[model samples]
Target: MLPLALLAGVATQLRAEEPRPAATTDFAGLILHLSEDPGKFHSDNFVSNEPGYPSAIEGLRALGIHGGAYIGVGPEQNFSYLAALQPERAFVVDIRRENTVQHLMYKALFAAARNRLEFLELLLSRPPPNAPEGESSRAAMSVQELLTAVDSRGASMKACEQTIDSVSARIEENFGFPLTDKDRVTLRHIHSAFAEAGLSIHYSSPKAVKQEPTLRELMLARDTYGNHVHFLASEKDFQFVKQLHARDRIVPVTGDFAGRQALRKAGEFVRDRGEVVSAFYLSNVEQYLRGAQYAAFVENVRRLPLNDRSVLIRCAFEKPTQRLPGDHSEQADGQFWPHALLLQRAQRFVELYDEGAFLTHEDLARQDYLDWTSGR
Candidate 1:
């Protein structure tokens, strides 16, 4: 019963002295280690920032992925999902070394950018908008508005190339991540791809594949309930991812989702920190995995610290009429669509492994994960 002001001051001091949660791993050191010792797997070049399946957002939200830790295979879509989940930490795992380099490029940009508008400006190497004089004012612009401004003042080829090189140099010199000549070339190519295409870059563009949705379309995509689900759809979501990147919480590792090294190490890090993996986003990687690879992936997942609430969000391409053993026949839609489904990791591992059902994508897809929440 001393003075009330004295008691308040003591309380503030105690709160200030409280211990914070230690980082599970040194982010930069871990990236350097993983890049130096990559897992034994190969993935083809996927330079575009566009996601293969934009509909995964529906499944992710349906599963109630709130955030602890997120591990995913792919490019920019992982960032989009991360924005939605607001995970405490994130790891982008891919088999391709170039993918890791691409992520590092993104990290450098994120670190360099002051806000979402500035991020897009730096990404495409376009000059910032003239109207917005300060960071606060520039950040007030919507994602779409920012894109429009950049699109209006397109970068020339020489300018774009120079910008790419400057950013690459910043990553190597300032960030302290050494880049090989080959890595620099690949990084330049990636940055050029974005600059050339602007917001309309797609997975199939310039490569001249069939019709594909642009990155802008994917970012503007809505969930099953017709809500805008893309990360850049809201200012809060964009800031959420940007803040995480600024904190060095979003780590990019060069490891296959089904590989031995990356996932195992990620699991160990999460376990060491006494944290649970909230969700793992498998974006149609199972379609390409062989039987043994699938098994190894499942085992790797099993090693992660997970609770009953942990979920696996999977993307698959299948016709509505295609049926597997024990798969229920629903109304024929007569079209192939990318379907996103969720499964409890512990439960699915036991069921699929025991039944020897990991042989094919169809085998995994046929299972009745309908009991679990899913959107599309």
Candidate 2:
């Protein structure tokens, strides 16, 4: 079972990140649709760090659109990318500080709840020598036992609700943004969407607690540290390129190297000059940056560079556990992890672009399992 201390930390991290819309002086109804996997869609829709998932940069160049109120691809993704994409777009929110407290609170509550579930697993399992006395050894359950257990579980769930409430309250007190039920539901909806879409919820853990913390912290820290000095310091660079093209009324091309190359050449003619923001799984970095994998990416890029300018890449971090979908093994049936599929599609894109990058990809879960069994 996970340590109680870890559970608390996870909850803390979540509440820190989640946003409470009602709490803000002004609300921007910006629905950020993240790509669970960039490769899943055609190259014309989404601009992601990965090879597939549609090219946001090209989309901007092709669409001749700039700032918007609704949902659709645009130039400037996260904060840094926004600066480079449209140094003029002022409505951008520094996502890190935007709803941090609420985000962290939700995460912590989830962590605590998950830990309780893990502990219950131990308690309800077949009793062994280490098992507490009077606990049943059999996995099978009688009708009464089952019903009673269900009641107990219901109580536990209620406790979980309280935990979240407490955290939310704390967030309100600290950040001056009190979370209303509506705000909580919206956040939950986003989490549900990510899970349903099969994309990994990167922020489903307390990053600060990890031995090798996920990249979310690195990116956020870099931005926070360099906020005053550099606009694109830590934000991924792909969005910047897209925004720049959008502002110039450049049309973006999505799909196939020939079309993209044509777009790139066109961008130059239209005075295309802007930063590119992109991200990728850490496992596939070698494919884009160096070694044989890099060569493969080059081969693909030669065919289609997607965007027309300078690019920046940043790593994403994992979120607290509860904010993440339930364990995949359970197949609880409500929602599937969309991020996983998103990444899988992204892998496909890399393969389409440069098979070398695809070859370098690694599964984080597989590694974790190996490490655990081998006591690594």
Candidate 3:
């Protein structure tokens, strides 16, 4: 076992070995992949230790992501720890880490910009016709309206642009790091892919998970912009939770009083929004069902409509809280898979859904045309 000081020393030594990491791209285009998982763990955790830590890079290389970035929460996860390990093979980015206060401000600002855009769209579609004579209008009211409208257009455009620019500038001003264009493009690509795949993923913080309606409408709109879009819920919110008996078929008790409720809410939310919603339990459902319940849970999941295109599952093991080890939701730690592993999973999602392939409007409009129609 490494002493705390020794581990800290090793971390320092790694930076000294390579002051600057290598770049993964060679001009073809960014081999885009994203991972929302945090990398914190015990000193001995597989992902933190050597050998296991490198598997993520291996996975991305396997997926042909030679030059791309891995997105994480903070500098600790973004800097040397992960990127240094793969040195130059990948770029690491730490997106916004603000809590709800600052997040709401950004959201309000984005809404204002989006509203301004809509107003412009409407104005362009139908320019006001010339004012009728004797309408108490100036002789050049129409022309003036056009010029005033032009000036208004410029002001509103600047206002909308400034909202994003100022917010981004303020963030960089305070944090000393600006949001990179690559980061913005990565998010747009993900959201576009998800939308094309027919999955509606919301971009919001844990505190604002209830904004599903807003997220859905945003996705529906032509322009959806953001750097970080997360699908998470506040465990404290009753509106986000549903009560379930331990005996419920979809939820297997894992020793926590809240386990049944969490599982129940996830299952019910997925089912209730059927057809209109694309929901997936990305956590390791297999590991969450332990001992006597694991077999039953696995068996039931196979029978469920899990393989449907609208659903996705990415399983990873985690540490269970109780002395009794095995599959248990409470034990789940997200860091079991590094950024590379998460990126591979995202690629698998694209392949699994056959996204980005040509599909006509008629084909898409066919309600039953799912990827698994061939029975894979």
Candidate 4:
């Protein structure tokens, strides 16, 4: 269980010393400027529901896809991708203002912690048992070992309250993003959920039928090749994300994919900076768009500048009688997700729309998943 401490970019070139993202002088103002007004309804998933998210990383690397800009939705799962892709900057757009506020909570956590163990410490509100101080030593530890070393005691009301205060202060004083009373309440509610559940927390949905993996399972999860690739899995991955957050390279925006302003404005910013999106993780939000909304989303995606190597990382679940076309076990299904971890050319996506291939959401979902070997 959690100790109750609760939580919590660059799109750049492929090189290790790649240039960082253009300066973000105003984080909150930029969020407002880039955001569309919140829709009437939105998914309230604070944590990622997708356990198979990392499977795409293996394919991403194998295809020589790395760095540029990453666009995604939902929660901490984006951290895992940021660790892998190391984009110059990222725009994590969701339809709800709560999502942006949630990202701010995460940003504060990232700013507070320095290493993987420290990150886990803040995340679970558990102090490190005997964490190593050396970067190399922490890098040598696996996620399982690192998490095992975290304090197992449940959270104290005092500690939980302190974290809430500290996180709010950090966002205001350090990051310059003030939290409204309502936002603070939402942040507290989200953090309280984390404290009550700790590492055992899993995505909850009224519509969920099967058990989703816990936070611990997701952290310990590996890519298709049996390599643990989640952000907290390695100290290096953790720091990559941490440093990026410190620089304000990752941003959150509110927008319905079908709505105007959000994606187009975000794309405009990236384009103005001469950056192109390399990968986009849509989860299963596409399943929610219908008719005109779906068409508007396709049009919005078309506005983003993309490169040949750019790809879309999406999910589709298996059916009782008809499984998605892949031998991989990285599949999830219920209502939202329709298939497993899927990778397809980003250019191909817009091309398909131009070719009049996606008359419906099913047509978009029915498009072929990229074969792994052909790119290599």
Candidate 5:
């Protein structure tokens, strides 16, 4: 193992980007071909905890970010970026095989439902949306109202049981991708977590010392203009992601950022398809990429096809030094908000590294990035 230092000789070996031959295959074959074997990660991130991710929408739009390949880490958070950018294609790359398995669960959910409300029914294990009872037509309700209605009804263990079986069947029918027994088990476990917890499920369980934001809160979150911006915020946004998943355009791969193969293969796939990666949701993965690993990660990034408009989406998080009223929800919940999404020019990242500006993670969070986000 290398110490936490980048060797100058390794830096000197960086070469210009080159294209790799495209593999001709369907969605299942593509996933199996592109992904590395299962790797280990510490947490079970079934739902995202980034409450302030809507700010990323405003930032990306401000920077004219849109339409190309979208690469991201984590669970469902990438959906919001997909909705905003309307990317031509997407890849969710993470070290955990569980993350990839969970994505298969999501693919099943999207495939089962037609619109946003029906999608929620399949997710929370609610009985199918029925005749007008307590609420009006499902289409008439706002995102907030839909979430509130679902939250009021307790999760049905009976429905959850049925949901798990259906998800398993759907995976076999739709994708036709062969999953290992462990992968199938992981898929069912992830689905059960969402159904049992309903909208209240979070990054960690609710009983933890620091309670994280719930799925309901995350979906209800708003952009800088106070417009709801999560993936389920609007019917159009929801449909965009739904169709993509049904078509298997959004692929999830178990890939270690610092390791070999996965990312490099993804870059090659993008290059061969003639698609440029417009937005990449880093989500603080750089914090873990130090020393030679960081250098290797940077090299992997440089392999992607990019244009001048491409940007990297990252979230900045911390523990408060003193009790300050920055955001009311954190104080009220007695938990820290692990996010405020920030943007950096993808090309600028490579340029800054060459200039010796990104020696530390702190250096990645400079004010100039803020300026760049604002078009200053």
Candidate 6:
């Protein structure tokens, strides 16, 4: 075997020689690819402005995830994780094409805005509060203060519509990605959701029968030990995501997790850049995957570049009595709630696959992978 120092040097040399995705075409290609794919698109809006899932920061931090590629499904929660992980690149894949359009809208706003406050101003269709003209002035305002400023001004339907149209047009004209009529209409509704609701937009599930927490509440939510883990909870956290957006590092792709094309192509792109997958956030999608779909997803994941440190973040819903290690929950009015976010090493999943141990979602969920760092 090669010496440790020699192996490290060789790895660094190989990374230096790899080709990176071009800034102009990387995002455009991802958008166009989703447009061409055959994945089923949902019509109704599935906007998740806040993370409805459990927090995985403790696991990610323990795994030392940084400066690598991130893959996940869903909305703004991805930005929060990206802010924390500071990945070189990120791909947000969802079955619904509307999600892709929503991300495109975000990309346009990020390209247009100069900072966190400016981004909020454009997103909420409201002006910023009067403050000194400097970075310190903006940073001094807390997340609550920012929300209050936005809510103080009622949603301006006319102004918000104009801004949305202008940004949508810029996305097509400047970014070179064409948007369909339906996409434009859908984008407008998404913008209205944020503008009208401000930070109070709650997580609305298609299958939900009851009310859920708003985005603001989720951001301020603490873990069992009273720790703030949401991405926008701090100015430093907000700046981290803003900088990543400014650099065009976050790309949204519309593809099913079990599909043949998207994840495979993403793996190819990461491999060409000589980077490994640091973390993947699978937000309760596995619960709906059938046998064939589950197998296909595992096969696709096998194609991605990963190491022992590569981790899978999964969310599961169980009874409060059936909680796993590191699981966090809250009790409301004496009702038991069981929501678990688990992190496991990628290699362990590969092992389970080889042994035919993952025949069902329950099989995958019941494992003690939550104790991910014990054997390592």
Candidate 6, residue 262: CA error in Å?
0.3
Q: List the candidates' TM-scores in order.
A: 0.78, 0.23, 0.21, 0.86, 0.85, 0.84
Error of 3 at 170 (Å): 20
lDDT of each: 0.63, 0.26, 0.24, 0.72, 0.72, 0.68
Q: In angstroms, how far off is 198's CA in candidate 3? A: 32
Prediction 6 global C-alpha lDDT:
0.68
Residue 92 C-alpha lDDT in model 3: 19
How are the candidates ranked when ordered by lDDT, highest leading?
Answer: 4, 5, 6, 1, 2, 3
Supply the TM-score for candidate 6. 0.84
User: Which of 5 and 6 is ahead in lDDT?
Assistant: 5
**lDDT by residue for model 3 over 1-376, one digit each (tens)?**
1112111111122112222233233211111112121111122110111112122223233333321212221111122222222212122111121211122222223232222222222222222233233423422233224234323421233333434455455434432233345334433343233223222233323333232222223212110121111111111111111111011111111111112222233334344545111222222222323333433433333322232223322222323232111111221122221111122133233343355331321221122211211221
Clashing pairs in 3: 22-88, 24-67, 25-67, 203-229, 287-327, 287-328, 288-328, 288-329, 319-331, 320-331
Candidate 4, 210: how far from true, in Å?
2.3
* Residue clash pairs of candidate 6: none
- Give lDDT tens digits, candidate 6, residues 162-272: 889888887777766667666677798888888887766755545554555566666666654466666666677776776776676777886667777778888888889
* Backbone collision tally, model 3: 10
Write down the worst ten-residue block by lDDT for model 2.
34-43
Model 5, span 1-376: residue lDDT tens: 0111112222222221343333334886777777765544435688877777777777777767888898998898889889999988899987666787788788888988776777788788865443235323655668877776666567777877887888877766667666666766787688788887888888764235567788888887776467888888787888899988977799988776665777888888998998999998877777767688888888888888988878887765543333211112243244456445667778888888978888777667553364323233
Residue lDDT tens for model 1, 1-376: 0011111111112111233232234565677555323332222233323233334555555557687899886677778779877789998876555677788788877777667776777777677445467777666766567657677776667767776777787766665566666667878878888887877665542343344456666665555355665666666777788788778788888666555578888888888898888888775566655566667777788788888777776654465454322122221123122343434455565566767765566656656553423132
Give per-residue CA lDDT, model 2, range 154-217, as digits (tens): 1233434444455465445543445556556644443333222221123332432422211122
Candidate 1: residue 88 lDDT (0-100): 93
Worst 10 residues of 4 by lDDT: 1-10
